[model samples]
Target: MWDYSDTVKEHFFNPKNARAMDDADAIGDVGSIQCGDALRLTLKVNAESEVIEDAAFQTFGCGSAIASSSVLTEMIKGKTLDEALKVTNQDIASELDGLPPEKMHCSVMGREALQAAVANYRGEVWKDDHEEGALICKCFAVDAVMIEDTVRANNLRTVEDVTNYTKAGGGCSACHEGIEEILTRVLAETGEAFNARASRQKLHASKEKPPVPGKGMSNLERIKRIERVIEMVRPQLQRDRGDVTLVDVDGDTVFINLVGACSGCQMASLTISGIQQQMMEDLGEFVRVVPVPANHAATTGVTA
Candidate 1:
């Protein structure tokens, strides 16, 4: 279980500024179907010119969402249009004292909803330059640059999926909501543009890695690489019923697979003891045999 800070617990239980404005001049709403977090922001802006008169929010998710929304409402109240636009997820996180790495996205989302709502109020549009060739999240179809900017700006989601896919955390596990922020921004900009973004990510994933020049090595030279091939190939061998995952490495080690009938076959122990043991022994002391399994484990009977 994660340790909830006192501030987090307090805000979770008693989130401030938790309501919807009856006479809101502008409104913004964001939701994530996968993570199950949603927020609605309302603003009362000064007419004649775009200035914020008041702000409020309603959120549905964890304590982080509630606290973020509550704090965001307090932060933007009485601020002018320009000043309120500057309010970011990081500011909300700071106002709450601080949030956990994962919950940072909640604060960040509140800020975006505010921005979207404010933009809706005015006739202005945020036309990003890299909208065409942006790298969306590989997982969630979030734009890369937008996610990066959102993470830096809001200090939200740190998980890799969130960062790359949604602008929460794409590169690593700590920032996910950042990915969601990017998704939200993109969806707001072009609600039906998800298809293009997803296709781009797929294209990137299917591309083969180009061979590096001058880095090529022969099979014999490469087999001598590293200390443990046994552990690496265990699962691969298991897939072929202990047939062959790793082939004979120059009569030293024989590569075998453990799959089909041999994966969970009752004769697995017999195969290991008879054929595997005899092959390794016949190969001599310096000779090593590598067996690759299908699922996880692999075995290499060698040290050097």
Candidate 2:
């Protein structure tokens, strides 16, 4: 189980200002129910002082999402829109003591909602959608611009880290190479070392290997070993209201489908990494875990 802070639990079980405000002066909406997370923030502003007199939110998501939204409403109350705008995602996580690295995206969502609400009040155009050319992750509607901004804001170091923060590269696995390119450029500009290939090699090296390496197993033997490793990891995910199913295996890449809560989870990247590490150790060979769409069979073929 995740080690949630006491304050996070408190706010989740007893969220404040969770009701809709019919007379709100400003409103912001983000995410979609189809995506397994959505939030609508409403604010009552004092016209003369430009202060947020009240705030409320309605969200459809996990406990962390509820806590983030609840704390955001309280934090922005009595502050001017400009003052509220300065509140970052880090601040929200701090206010709740702290959120797990996997749950940090909840805080980011809260910050975006506040920005959208302010834009609404100002009568300015605010959109989260991107053009097809700029889109990066079609599964989550995450664009390259969003990925770049998040990498800078969070100092993200890996494709997994980006998935935890922005849900990019968390599904299909086809956008991973694209995400790595963005990360490489961003990290270079910031004077950070981000050798994508080296980083991946390092991750593989960090995993424990078999005591004695065998010559190599046949394809049938390899598939069975992968299945056994996945079976070992499946119970842990199921305990958390999620599950995984093997879709197909092609050479070093093992395709799988995340079902239940795991389907759109922000922690998916970590989950995939864990599965990959285990498979490599058990099979005594390099392997990559790639999450495919649940309906992968309907598609032409899994890529990446």
Candidate 3:
């Protein structure tokens, strides 16, 4: 039972474009059952005009997810691809008068589905800029480009803010630190939005927490947590015909090496980002994981 806004409840109960469009020019579908939400979007485009004549969606998700998709379709109708591309998760949430922090990810799914459809319309390639960056959130397949874009687009200031706008850290929470780093870096780019050094200081200044047993995670406990996160995300890589092996853990940095098919795959940056994010969520916010760098894991799409 959540206190959903009137718009959210209205769209959830009577979603627009709820039916399928068999003649859609492009269809973008993303998310998974494991993540608890998925969207299938279809659009009928007027190619000569380069405009979306009609759009429809069939979503399998919570109330927010459905509502997000519903509102998304309405927003994009009669707009050119350029105009549609500008629509983001923030726009969807704003339309619904905002969502609870934890449920923000649902809106993100709507945006992804629309992006995928737009990409499909343009071509089979996933032209979304984020796919080229590190994939930070595996549960929802969130990438660094996506998170950075959301932060910049909405001026997200904190990890929780990132989650609110893009749901980057809402799922497993392993990517909380990774998202925080991105938030800091994005803010630093503006030269006034944030202080990266101060942010890092905050993450490392946890020494005040007593080292007493049961008071906080011990070194051994932390190592075990890291291992569990690896195991949890390992299957996701395997599905891509790739493999990852732990190489070393240096302070906050966990270095891993990619192998097999993924060793040379162009999508490795995304893979590395996914691994780092999951570890941060499982191990807590101070983690800074990196791949062994294929050279140095190809510099990871998300830079320091």
Candidate 4:
């Protein structure tokens, strides 16, 4: 289970502003059914163009969602419209005491809902400055420049390859549109062709492992063993400026991705085949270790 923050747990168990305002000047609704988190906010503006009257919200989400909405309402209740608009998503996240990395977007949604409500009141169009130019990543709020920089720095080629450098479409699948756009921009900007053979060669080299005969293990057991090994060896690997993750397990061979400060470090290749490989070997002879490429696939948002 997720460790809920004290403030987040309190708001979740006993949410405030859980109803619509009777004479609300504006109402905003944002979210998609696919994401399983939605919010509805109502605001009543006073004569001085401030939110002096009242505010309320209804949220269908996990603790983060409920806390984000509840806290947002409380924060904006007595503030002027301008002050309320200044309450950023980061502000909301911080007010909740904190939210998990994945849940940061929920706080972001709360901010979006508030902005939408204000815009609805003013009859203004909604625009995301984060996507003013280039292209927009519908999935993770990333822009073309962000995707291109990540790809070029990491030497990524395919759509999946982009995931490692930048988590563009790793969130809501709705962002696939933005991914395709960024991919096109990258291809056009580079004017360089993708070499299928080279890509395959890189992938294959990353998956190297000696063949092991007939020693079988259930997938769950292998996964559990891999997880244990990952936790045990992570600190040691980090000491050498590297981190490891279980990518895939085929038969007895376990594929791992070494990343972060270690990605392009001088000893990366050696550490993967030497230290990590040796550690897994102690587990079982059939456990062949492979160093999957840094650019393998996008990390889907953490499972809630």
Candidate 5:
């Protein structure tokens, strides 16, 4: 069973702006019965200010999909088109207090519907995704560019992460191979190899006395190694207006403190686990992580 957060349940049961707008300036209706999820998004814009005067949605799918649509409409209201364009799937998930990873595509669908709706309003082509590259996932109409962008943006490593984030290989299992190819290229572009032991190999192969990648190292060296990996991870979190501060390290147990938009989120523990997983993958299985209590960080006045 999956844990549906309070925010997701709240919006699912009592959705906001879940209605058809006959007078909408622009409308985007997308998805299919095959996918078990579809969204129709409508918007009314202020002619002069270009602000979104109102937004509404009609979604057909799971509770998360409906909640995602409801929350997306609520979040973009009163914002300018450009501001709304900046709202990503991560923002929708965060607004819902975070979704189960497998349901993340529901949030992605909401963002896509909004973009399609906005494109209609501006008299632009509804899907410019093709301009980025050829189509890869026929089931969801996912293209190469979209897949690559999602992989790089989230630092996704596994085939499952790609499916969860982009819905590319979620349909037929055939695209899994293609998605893996793209993921490999993206990871290569980061100048790092995939596999949980790749970084360890790098450490062992180096002669410059660089910090080793796991346990049984000096505290200072271990901290240096972990901090280096965090440097790679933090920017993605910060891009979503969330942050994690290193509180302390105890053997395999690493402590982190969430900050910024993530500070009050109900899914902070999930976020911490994600951080831990990434860190362990990079450094080794010897590492585990937990979020430090807010009270502790508060008293210590630590910033993420």
Candidate 6:
């Protein structure tokens, strides 16, 4: 069973503003019941001051979802619409002490609802269909823009991190590749390295063994695990304004391309040796880390 925080349980058992406001000045609706989560937020704004006088929510989801929506209403109660727009999903999670990573998507839902509500009040066109970006996760109706924004907002690294925060790859695993592509682009753009250990510590804290490697592992699984290991060593490389990108993995051989300062550094061999040692330790297998030329075209796999 998932552990529920005390504040989360309190709101779940007795949620505030759980009713519909007949005199609401604006209403924001998001999510789909077909996707197993939906939320409707109502607000009563003072026309002259543009401050939210009242707020309420009616949500169809798990306890965390209800609590998130319930708490969001309270958070926005006396704040102006502009002020309330600044509230992020992280703030909602922080307000409730903390939520299980799996339930973090509930907080994201609440943040979207708030945005929708504010947009409605301002006569803007905002809908859950997410027409701005291509739909990446058909099961959850998550779009590329949503995934990219969440990744930037939370500094997400792995597909698992995106799944936890946005529910993009949580359903059918088909969108995993799309999510990874987005992560790579966003992290590269910001020059931010993925912290694989920190993002996944909670989930693996109790596991004694790392996943078995190189047995019947599929190509995608190998790439994912390889990328994780690269992310683990990326910070060290990034410290010197250098980075490594996973180009391809053929059997036990991993192809990588060094970029920036490490591209032609004298210590590139030592860095590759360190990465090889780390990969062997983490993957529980002997592997070769080969550096490709800077302009090498990768046939398959993802950059870390």
Most TM-score-accurate candidate: 5
> How well is each residue in 49-133 modelled by candidate 6, as lDDT tens digits?
9899999999999999999999999999999999999898878988898787567778989999999999999999876654336
lDDT by residue (tens digit), candidate 2, 50-169: 999999999999999999999999999999999999998778988999787567778888988998999999998787643222777866657788899889999889887787677777
What TM-score fits each model? 0.42, 0.47, 0.46, 0.48, 0.54, 0.47
Clashes of each: 77, 0, 8, 1, 0, 0
List model 4 lDDT by residue over 1-304, tens digit each: 7677999999988999898677789888888667688998999888666654688998888889999999999999999888899898878977898777557778888998999888878889766443223435543445667787777677677655664345555455466556556656666677976544654575586467553433576657657767887887688666534588877665555667888656764445545555455445645554556677756532332223
lDDT of 6 at 196: 51
Clashes counted in candidate 1 amount to 77
Across 233-283, the per-residue lDDT of candidate 5 in tens digits comes to: 678678658887787776677777788866765445546656665676667
lDDT (tens digit, per residue) of candidate 1 on 1-304: 5466667677778887778689988888776656588888898888866667788788889888887887777778888878888886667776787676546667768877877787777755633233212434332234566565554555432243332223222233333343444545555554433233553474365343232222354555445441244454455444432443444454444555555545554445444444443333332233334445444232344444
Candidate 2: the clashing residue pairs are none
* Pairwise lDDT winner, candidates 3 and 6: 6
Summing lDDT over every window of 10 consecutive residues in candidate 5, give the lowest-scoring window: 203-212
Give lDDT per model, in order. Answer: 0.57, 0.84, 0.75, 0.71, 0.78, 0.82
lDDT rank order: 2, 6, 5, 3, 4, 1
Which portions of model 4 show Cα errors greater than 4 Å? Answer: 128-304
Between 4 and 5, whose lDDT is larger?
Answer: 5
For residue 303, model 1's alpha carbon misses the true position, in angstroms, by 53
CA RMSD per model (angstroms): 18.4, 15.8, 18.1, 14.8, 9.0, 16.8
lDDT of 2: 0.84
The global Cα lDDT (0 to 1) of model 5 is 0.78
The candidate maximizing lDDT is: 2
